[model samples]
Target: MTADGTAPTEEVGGWLDKLGALLRTVGLVVAMGETSLIARNIREPEGATAAGRAMNPGLRQEVVCQPDATGVPWWFWVWQGPTRDAPGELEPLCPAANLEWAAERITRVLAMPEGPP
Candidate 1:
């Protein structure tokens, strides 16, 4: 239900594929967390995880495509609560078709902090 009466043309998994390809080529890990829900999991490259970090530091972000008020779907980054597995906020990034843009933004946000000196 966009401004017009038609449903969104793009499929949710399409975004995953577009973003996954770019992320994978760049050394990031892309995984399908919940296929039924179409959740995409992103993680830091192997050996890049900080030493002595959390139990699971590689996980970067989980993204999904959801519809807006008008029924047009957009990409959104799902943030868990302050603690792992807690409730968090949902922020839309870009349109579903802007898969590359969403991936770039994710990369920037998930970029590992500079190592000591």
Candidate 2:
């Protein structure tokens, strides 16, 4: 339970389910992984940095959702770009109270040509 006496697991699952549905509507395929929900085609980098090249020849965009300390789940736009030493970078998007708001925010970000830092 969280500080507010809410079950974090249940809250997280609810939003994840909503996100899964929204992603399907947008034609973005989502797969349930061990820890996070993985979505494809949401990010694609034009060029590869040295760090990116070191890890892989081509970099792809992916959206991931992971639970955090707060009841609200953390959304991430993964592989936005390469960091100084890391092959890829993860940008924290936002934490929303409900799936609708989260889907809107995610859709807006996904529409952008450039991925977040």
Candidate 3:
């Protein structure tokens, strides 16, 4: 992490590498880590800071950011609900980047046999 709240160059790369390693463990051709949890932190355009950019290097499979609303970047927040709204989603948003508890969860999930898509 950098003093400006952006991620350091190496830090971003490291996170991306860690993400790749986690995905490889799961045998996923394309890893889909969650991001809504991390995206919520940004309120402004500049909020797409390096720290934010590096936070979710993995792909988002279920949710996407609402298009260009509030000037926040598309990378921030997971689009939730059946209508794909910006709010009211559950289960800690992105399973990949929910660093709060994901480290263990990811390890466990990756160890299990691939589930039905």
Top candidate when judged by lDDT against the true structure:
1
TM-score of each: 0.66, 0.49, 0.33
**lDDT-based ranking:** 1, 2, 3
Which 10 successive residues of model 3 have the least lDDT summed? 35-44
TM-score, model 2 to reference: 0.49
Cα lDDT tens digits for candidate 1, 1-117? 445644444455655677677777666777664321222234444455456345655546777676766677777777777888787667888887786787788777767655543
Please, what are the lDDT tens digits per residue for candidate 2 over residues 71-94?
A: 456766666445566655667766
What would the TM-score be for candidate 3 when compared with the true structure? 0.33
Query: Candidate 1: where is the Cα deviation over 4 Å?
Result: 1-10, 34-56, 82-88
The residue pairs found clashing in candidate 2 are: none
TM-score of 1: 0.66
* Candidates' C-alpha lDDT: 0.63, 0.59, 0.38
Clashes of each: 0, 0, 5
Clashing pairs for predicted structure model 3, backbone only: 7-50, 7-51, 34-94, 36-78, 39-77
